[model samples]
Target: MDIAIVGGGAAGFMAAITARRTNPSCKVTIFERAQKVLAKVEVTGGGRCNLTNSFAAISDLKQAYPRGYKLMKRLMMTFNHEDAYRWFEEHGVPLVTQDDDCVFPKAQDSHAVIDCLVQQAADLGVMVCCKSRLMDIRSMQDGRLELIFDNGTQRIFHRAIITTGGSPKGNNLQYLARLGHKIVPPIPSLFTFSIRDKAFCNLMGTVVDPVVMTIPGTKFRSKGALLVTHWGMSGPATLKLSSHAARMLAEQDYKSPIAISWTGERSRQEVEENILAMQIANPRKQLATLHPFGLPSRLWVYILSKLGLEAAKPWAEIGRKTFNRMIETLVNDQYTIMGKSAFREEFVTCGGVSLESINSKTLESKVCPNLFFAGEVLDIDAITGGFNLQAAWTTGFIAGSCVAE
Candidate 1:
């Protein structure tokens, strides 16, 4: 049996590996358009290749995905984080989980993961044909599928798995759309908001506790540790907002007002009370020197400057209006986002082949039988950390197990 996997990414590779193991007699081949495979995995988590997360509960894991959460209910139940951990370790890749619950290979490098997957594929007789871009896919008269390649090569496979990752353009998925599937307009997710404010640029590298970030006039909001990047605000919180609000932000052309509360869980009144107490406790202390609310020294300094207050001004000198202004700046600061850029190249998309067109139970296309999908190719994406990779692995594993020889 000739089984063609039309991608060489994490999901495609996992599908290939699964198919080969499930039916060892079947001939499996990965058709990748790139010069090499696992390009995204090689760079995920800054080259550490965060393979999976340590979220033990399905409820916890289910919350991370912005789209396809309902569709993934069965998929996650089938092969979740625990199963992923055991699979890698059982396949000879030592794994480690950090306090943050991100899982990475013990070797502390993406190469370790790429090598492990490649070695396993090679051992299982799965051929990874790089630079073999699929130009078209058509059903044959004999119940087979014909894959036309850019290089003028063609192959007839008894079954096929479409694990092509998220495409930045809708035209890229036109071939699949022609196969009777609906394409959700793809938009960038898990990205950093581009704030043109000079103060934001100057505050690069500022890491703060979980901040409550929200898109004005939308139900989109998230709370997590935020990092001020050279480009813009990134880190877990911002990325989560981006993922969940991808469509809303895109509709606004990426230009929108954002509200952030430095005191993540605290209400504005709570922050105000805390600041008032600090003033009474340390009347002679300089505002910047006091670092109210335990904010980072640099961040506190910036907040003061942003409010047009002198850092050396004593707490006692803070006027009633200025005090209220300080409270607002700390708990209700607003910034206009001009644009966005990929959050490391791990940028995911909330849009893809609509989840309704596929069978969640088998990861197969209801529009076209024998044609399956996994990973970002489907309308499934999650926020930062290792959730995206976990989805890819789970879907790929399911597709691989279900595909016929």
Candidate 2:
């Protein structure tokens, strides 16, 4: 049997290797568009290559995967994070889990991962054809699949797996769309919001943890450490919130109002009580001197300045109206999301080939036999951390395992 894997990425490599392993007599090949393969993997997670997540904090898969939770839940039965962790370690890459539950190679370099995949494929005799962009895919009458490359080369394969990852625009997936698969319009996910407020941007270096951010008139919300960037906010909370609200934010033209609770998951009443206790505990202390809720001093001062409150005033001098206003600001600080900026080198999109058109068990296209999909190309995406890569490994494993069947 001959198998072709298109787009040499995390999923493509994994699929190629798994296919060869599942049916050792089969010949497998990877066709990559770029001059080299695994380009994104080289720079992902700032070059450390976050392989998978421990998922210790995730009781529900939806918490990590904003989209495709149901499909992922089904796929996890065959290959989950634990399986990925074991696979990497058994393959000679030592792994470590950070405090945030993100797993990376102990070597602390993406090359460690790159080397592993390349070596594994080489050992498995998987043919890697770089600079081989697929322009079209057609089902052959003989039950084979024909892959037409940009270079005018055509190849017939018994099975094909599309692991092309996410494309920023719809046209990139046109070939797959021609095959009758439902294509979800691709939109950016896991990005940073661009805030136009110059004053807020001035707090670029400020980082607040355990803060809750919510989009108004929407059910999207995220809680984590938020770093104020020069242009806007970029951090776990912002990235997660962006993932959850990717479609809505895109519809709004990236212009939406966001509500943030400086006090984290604390209720408004709790914020009030905490403020009251702070005032009582430090009656004579200046408001500016004592920051509440373990908030950074600069952020607290910025909040006070925004409220037009005298920073030099003693805590005891706080009036009922001012206290209420303070409580409101602490729990409901508002900001407009003017635009979006890419989160470093990572470009993740939530939209792709909708899962409705694929078999959940094998990740094979329901419309086209012997054609399967894995990774970001399948309308599946997750927030920051290692969830995205986990999706890649699991889906790739499943597709390769069942592609020949």
Candidate 3:
């Protein structure tokens, strides 16, 4: 069988290698638009290339994917994180899991991971064509898939797999959709919110731990570390909420009000009681100098100012109304998200090809026989920490294995 894999990204490369491994006599070709393959993998995780996550069960892993959790649950059961780790280990690329369960190459370099894929494909006689852009694709009268390249090159294959990622520059989706497949509109995921707050200026390095961030009008909430930026807030918590609320935020034109709780572990009543105890412990101390409840001193001052409380006033002199206001700000700090900043290292989309169109068992298109889908191209995206890449590996392996047979 002659197999044509579009997009020389993580998914495409994995699919090519798997196809060749499953059927050594079959010819597998990977066409990449860019001069370099795995561009995102080279820069992902700050050059570490978080390959997979440590989540064991399909149920636990599906929680990270908001768009295609149900589909991913079924796909992961076939080839999940453990299988991915073992595949890498067999190929001489051992992986290590970090404290947060993010798995990376033991060499601590993305090039190591990319090199493994490149070498594996080469060893399996997979043709990796770089800078070969797929301009169009059509199903011939004989039921073969023909691909037209930008450089006036054409090739026909028995089967084709599209794993071109979620970039607007690529023609993978357009060409595949022209062949008659539903294309779900893609949106930016795993991004940070842009806020118009001056308090965040010159405080770009300030990070608050264990903060709860939520998007109003949506049932999205995340608790993790948050960073204050010149434009607004960022970090794990903000990015996770942004991903889960990507569609909602886009519908609002990225101008949505977000609520943040600095004390993620404490309730409003608990915060108020803690403040009362601090006030009793240091009645004569000024609010600015007291810095109660373990929050950042600058943030405490800002919260007091927002609550209309004088920072120089002693703790004993503050009225119950002001105390309540401060409690409210600490427990429910609100910020208007004016825009979004792409986490350029690993920006993923939450939606793509509808799951209903693909068979979960083999990742083969239910609408088209011998045509498969995988990776971010298939309406499946997960939060950070290598979950998205794991999905790609899983679906790509399944598609390649089933197609090769």
lDDT of each candidate versus the true structure? 0.88, 0.93, 0.84
Model 3 spans > 4 angstroms off: 56-62, 169-172
lDDT of 3 by residue, 3-33 (tens): 9998898999889999998999999999999
Model 1: per-residue Cα lDDT over 161-236, one tens digit each:
9998988888889998998899999888878888898877788989987899988787888888989987778888
List pairs with backbone clashes in candidate 3. 352-379
Q: Could you say which candidate leads in lDDT?
A: 2
Clashes of 3: 1
Local error of candidate 3 at residue 280 (angstroms): 1.1
Cα displacement (angstroms), candidate 2, residue 117, comes to 0.7
Number of colliding residue pairs in model 1: 0
lDDT ranking, best first = 2, 1, 3
lDDT of 1 at 108: 92
Lowest summed-lDDT stretch of 10 residues in model 1?
Answer: 55-64
> lDDT of model 1 at residue 288?
83
Candidate 1's displacement at residue 287, Å, is 1.6
